[model samples]
Target: MAKNNEFLWRRLHSLLGIIPVGLFLTQHLIVNHFATKGVDAFNEAAHFMESLPFRYALEIFVIFLPLMFHAFYGIYIAFTAKNNTQRFSTFRNWMFVAQRITGIFLVIFIAWHVYETRWQVAIGADKADFNMMADILGNPWMFGFYVAGVLAATFHLANGIWSFLVSWGITQSAASQRVATYVTLGIFVALSVVGIRALLAFVV
Candidate 1:
């Protein structure tokens, strides 16, 4: 029963990544890309998001709750799992370790990002506009942090997608898994380009 429960939680964890969390990341990048069009475009995008029906509720269910479950359960898995990367020393093994490392960084980055942008705006402490984003990203350290954070996030999501495929029994064979690997790699590269471009829109 204990083993079955663990398996169930693991399956849920993988499923949650692709459903709301992964889909949200893609949507977020698209919205943020509006910054490239200028401040007005970016602000309009922000406004549109805020104008959605039951905005707070949507955020709580679609974003925050899923994120909390994914993040905390991920941490639990990281802590409990036996990492034998040292003995294995293979590409896949390294990526397994990297996944956990990136997850930790992502948790930190996402928390800080949400606090700085969402919570601040919610409390009337800051405006959700291009200038506000530019001001934050214009700083050298902050810019670097954003770059690193986005890279980590994209990689984690990309790898998680591949893992999700396997976990769901969608890619069982070696040939299919290899194809999934290449596809996920492509996703990482594409998302990294979009994410970094959006960040640069703030910097430049």
Candidate 2:
């Protein structure tokens, strides 16, 4: 029973990553890309998001809850699982380690990002807009941090998708897994480009 529960939770964790969390990340990148069109366009996008009916409720269920579960359960998995990459240098093994490492980095980055943007706006201390992002990213140090964070996040999501396929038994054969890996690599590259472009829109 305990083992079954563990399996179920792990499955749920993987499902959450590809569903609401992953979908949210894609939407976030698209919205942030509007910054390239200037402040007006960016703010208009923000206003549209805010104007959605029951936006806060949607945020709680679709964004916050899933994100929190995925992160915490991920941390639990990371801590409980053994890392044998050093002993066995295989591609899949290294990717397993990389997933954990990136997950840790993302937790820190996401917390800081949410506090600086969402929490501040909620408390009336800041507004979510292009100017706010520009101010944050204008600093060289902050810009570098964002670049690193975005890359880590992109890799994590892409790799998570690959893992999700295997976990759900969608890619069972070695050939299929390899194809999924290549596809995920392509996704990582594409998302990285979009993410970096969004970041540059603020500073450049």
Candidate 3:
């Protein structure tokens, strides 16, 4: 019973990780494309989400749960794997590292993002206001960090799509997995470029 429960929970975690957790990040990026419009845009997007069905409750489901599982399991996998402290032992080893490094990054980046966009603005503690997006983007450090984070996010999502597909038994063949990987990579690149450009434009 205990073994079955752990196995079941892990599977459930993977499934939830695939849903709005994985799906939502891509969607979230697209929505945040409006960030180029500045604070009003970001606020409008956030507000729109709040208006959605059982917004708070849904957030608990979408935002908290899967995120916790993915992050926890991810850390567990990372540390337990031989490559955690050693070199990329093999292809599978590198794959795990790729996912884990991005996962770790996302943990920090997302927290900072929430602080900057959600709490800061909500509390009216932000200094940039809506129109100053250009200045924020123009800053060398901020722009650099933002671009890196965007790319990392894109990579994370792309890799996650592969993880989700294989876990779901959607494609078992190597050829199919390779094709899916390429397709996801292409999509992430396109979205990241568009999102980054939009943000840069908005800031200017």
Candidate 4:
């Protein structure tokens, strides 16, 4: 019974990570990427999202709840799961280690990021505009932190995609898994560029 419950939870975790959570991340990166165009472009995109009907309700139900489950359960998995990187010392083993490390880091990174941006906006302490990001990223330390956060986020999502495919039985063959690795690597690189460019736009 316990094993079956855990299996279902793990499957749910995998599904949620790819569904609303992954989709939200992709939309967020795309919106932020508008920064590369100009302040007005970014602000327009942000404003459009902010103006969506039932936005708060959507965020709570679709984004936050699923994310909290994924994050918290992921933390549990990270600590409990065995990492055989040293003994096995294979590519996938190393990836497993990296995934856990990044997952833990992302919990910290995402919380701080939300506190700084979304929470602040909710409390009327800040605006969701380019200038707001500019003020935040103007500091060298914060800029470095944000860059690291972006890299971590992109890597986590990309790698998580590979895991999601295998766990969901979409990638049954070794060759398919290898292809997934390459595809996800490309996704990581592309999203990293987009995220870093957006951050650079804010500061530079």
| lDDT by candidate, in order shown | 0.92, 0.93, 0.73, 0.93
Tell me which of candidates 1 and 3 scores higher on lDDT. 1
All candidates: TM-score: 0.96, 0.96, 0.79, 0.96
- Model 1: weakest 10-residue lDDT segment is 1-10
Indicate the residue-level lDDT of 166 in model 1. Answer: 87
| Superior candidate under lDDT, 1 versus 2 | 2
lDDT score for candidate 3 against the true structure: 0.73
TM-score-superior candidate, 3 or 4: 4
What are the runs in model 1 whose C-alpha is more than 4 Å off? Answer: 1-4
Pairs clashing within candidate 3: 133-203, 134-203, 134-204
lDDT of 3 at 179: 92
Worst 10 residues of 2 by lDDT: 1-10
Off by over 4 Å in 3: 35-47, 84-93, 122-138
- Record all residue pairs in model 4 with backbone atoms less than 3 Å apart, i.e. clashing: none
Number of the candidate with higher TM-score, 2 or 3: 2
Q: Encode model 2's per-residue lDDT on 30-126: one tens digit a residue.
A: 8888988888999999989988999999999999999999999999888887899779999999999999999999999999999999999999999
lDDT of 1 by residue, 67-106 (tens): 9999999999888878998799988888899899999999
